[model samples]
Target: MVSAREEILNKLKKAIHPEPEMPDFDAPVYHAIDKSLGQAFKENLEAVNGSVYLCKSEEELVEKLKTVLQNVPEKEVVCSENELQELLTKNGIEHQDYQERQQAIEAGITSCEFLIAHTGSVMGSSALQGARQMLVYPPQHIVIAKKDQLVDYLHTAYDKIQEKYPDQLPSQITLITGPSRTADIEKTLVMGAHGPRELHVFLY
Candidate 1:
């Protein structure tokens, strides 16, 4: 004879049904909104306590970076993009390479895969050689991107990412909107609770 526990389990198993097949998902439909993509992005970013700057040229970008460094005066900087080194040097902002990236890095400069205007999000990955850590560990994250990188929505950004690495994808991808914030502990509400406190995007 079967034991009481075995008899109960057998009855329960018979009552269970087969799992259903997953359903297919189609592209989403989005409603229209006012304001151009860049404008929307800037507005949303600022609403979340992030900063945005538009630069007409590399010179202007570097100039603005110089001003930022001047304001901080004592924080260490880490540059993740090699293309930006010349600009940093031209502007006389002392910064080390990504090798120096750490929690102590007050600012991190890097490129991105795309900027989603709908949510004011900046997305990047190892495919772009963007250190996943630099996106979080630094107190300030300064992203340098071109206007051409803007996309209307997040899905479009993912599509672009797929096209970029068709053969093999990077191990890590990150999407960031504003300064990191959390109120998990006692609902005190803290910014940069887990990631960078400041997020500044320079779009040209």
Candidate 2:
């Protein structure tokens, strides 16, 4: 008998269109993975007009984020707890409770690290202390991932998870790609049907 995971994977395979070629799982897979991830993100975040930015370090990323916040009209910066607090205090951006702030942010914006990209899916995980709202509530989501984290495929992500936590996994693992969409109304396409309308990725 097939396990629940296998059954779900089979359904996912049928639901999502397959790529022309399987992603290479070799050491050089990072480049291809990055390209694929970037393409997927661009396709999902249409209003952003495929804008993507790459930064080398945390300092550089912070600087770019500040610029984005300043230059983009009415744009709010939504980040994880640590980054949020630092930015609020240092930059004097007034913020409410982290949870409430995240909820408001999720209604419009968010940021994360792309843990896995496969089948056009971007995976993100959160810790107990971390705010999951940053990942879930945003209408537009931006992710920052190191080039080294780009794996060839979903199976590679699973392997890494196993290796990293042999005994147990996290309570939740989110795999997102593209905008939340549906064609339920007589096959008419609708974006942001359930979740974020856009997904932006920044790789460095």
Candidate 3:
């Protein structure tokens, strides 16, 4: 008597084909249509319930950020980067220190390494100078990025990261496509189950 597992393995072994040739290093892993990378990134991210704000300048970026944080108190918003903190302070938008009151943080504003346009993902790494928790623990995650940071695909993003850090890569690299969500219990969808419930990206 032949076991079902053994029979399936034998059939698969007999049907194996020759290994295909490897692609060239410069070969494109993905083909993107002729369109703005920022637009594509915005559209894809918005499709997953994430919000994007396109700012023409730093002043406009600050203005838009103010509107987003209008309802939330300054004490609840956490910002760590010195440059961002200075910008917030200069604009009269006070924020709490990221090191303090971890549990009370309602929103977190952080910089990202790169933004992948195709998947609408933000590439973050510990090399940026903070714990990965800064991205996940907050109920609302706010990312501030530049237009130059946008890339066409994940492969290109990886290549850029490698070029940027030729010595060694960060121990942790995270690609956040959208806010955290789960549909495990009885197929009932829930947001913020494992991480932030809301994701907002401001690009200039």
Candidate 4:
């Protein structure tokens, strides 16, 4: 007796097509677009509702941050970087130092390892910044980066990461482009589904 499973398998066996040869992927991939790295990054990031600012100096970066941080609730920003912390304190902004128990954080302000210009991505690792949870737990994400940290391509950022951590990479490395978003429910777009909905990069 031919059971339902046997009948389905026999039908599938009767229908077959010639297999096509696999294409070669050994060659390096190439992209054709505007060559301006910073401009491209700003455009790409803004396209997804993320904000980007090019700061000429640390003072300017601090001022911009102070204004933007006002949007967060309780004017609370969490950060672990000592230098940045000092600057924020001097500016009279109230921010909680990175702590395990401080769960009601308005935003996590971190410095990223590299900013990929072509893809508008901010690459971060535990060694470059803080814990893995800091990247994921916050409702808002603010990345502070210098002009030197900008790279033209994503592979270039990976190369830099490898150079920095030659022996072993950090336990967690993340590549974030714009805000956390999805189009899963009834084809409607939503942000902050899995991570921070608001992503702001202060590039100086």
Candidate 5:
């Protein structure tokens, strides 16, 4: 049966490309990364009413966050470590653990990583721990993805995952695009009906 499936797939591939040459998967991946990152930046800027900063190190990240939060009054910073605690304390912003703050952010925005982007979906792994709640419960979400994580599409992301963990894929995989929206009430479009009203991505 496996052989038959392979044969069928091979035939389909050949039929689609008569030359039967290997596709330049890397090119598409690169282009997708560039395009998606640009789009994500624009969308995020608009959605978050904030700017995305690409930092090379933790120190730079802290500095950027401090600068951004300088003008925002009464902004509580939610994070997971003592490192961030130090930064927040120095900046005079209240800090809360990412896990402990989940309830508070249930109506706020969360941020996470994008496992795939084919359909503009955001993927989160359990290993990220309590960060998942940050991405789900808020009215707005922001994600910071490294350049290498970008793929041409969802299947490519899946392929990369399989390659990295041949036998240990996570039990749950989420593909989210845009905001959690609906139009059930008198067919009127509504945002944040079920979840966040906006989804933003910062590709760095």
Candidate 6:
């Protein structure tokens, strides 16, 4: 009186195989990245439809920022950092403070805690100002980062965070690899599904 399901289970039990041994995770698994961390970050970021701009000087950075802002509407752009706001104002670039205009924000400029080169990711945390909204609310995200902020691996980034905040750590940490996208609906890729459709990283 063995039913079809019981017969199938008995046959599967007879053919079951032993579990394989797990490899040593402490040992280095990935190949060592030959290029500089900055280069690796740029290449990996670009591979996921993200844009990277390397600026050599402050003037160049401002100019590049201005160029990017030109495509976005004047009032639709939001910046929360006081330093970045000052820079934008100094350059005659019109932008609203995120607090001032939370509605219809087309773009947002933010600073990240660390940049992971191996995965081309930006590590942000609730501890950082404007990280929660400036990152996900806007249609376009512009991250200002320096070459020194680049880390070779995610673990190294975490170690650095621990060192930086010895007493209190951020409540939430976010790792953004590329533009927010998903292929959930019938496997059709859709950008800006859950967050910013465009991610731009300006590295100096």
- Best model number under TM-score: 6
Worst 10 residues of 6 by lDDT: 98-107
Tens-digit lDDT string for candidate 1 (54-173): 788878887887777676634378886777777777777788776754436678888888998888899988766547767877788889899999888888998988898899877888
Candidate 5 ranges with C-alpha deviation above 4 Å: 1-76, 81-94, 106-117
* Lowest summed lDDT window (length 10), candidate 1: 24-33
Q: What is the lDDT of candidate 4?
A: 0.82
TM-score of each: 0.79, 0.58, 0.84, 0.81, 0.56, 0.86
Residue 111's lDDT within candidate 3 is 92
> What's the CA error at residue 81 for candidate 6, in Å?
1.1
* Stretches > 4 Å off in candidate 4: 1-28, 100-103
Candidates' C-alpha lDDT: 0.82, 0.57, 0.89, 0.82, 0.56, 0.90
Clashes of each: 0, 2, 0, 0, 2, 0
Tens digit per residue, CA lDDT, model 6, 1-204? 999999999999999998988988899966688998888999999999999998898789889988888878899989999888887788888889988884689989988899999989999988777878888999999999888888999999999999988999998889999999999999999999999999999999
Candidate with the larger TM-score of 5 and 6: 6
Model 5 is weakest, by summed lDDT over 10 consecutive residues, at 106-115
Residue-level error in angstroms, candidate 6, position 97: 0.9
Q: Arrange candidates, best TM-score first.
A: 6, 3, 4, 1, 2, 5
The 10-residue segment with the lowest total lDDT in model 3? 94-103
lDDT of 5 by residue, 74-142 (tens): 334455435435645775655466666534442322334343433556666554555556656655554
Query: Order the candidates by lDDT, highest first — what do you get?
Result: 6, 3, 4, 1, 2, 5
Poorest stretch of ten by lDDT in candidate 2: 102-111
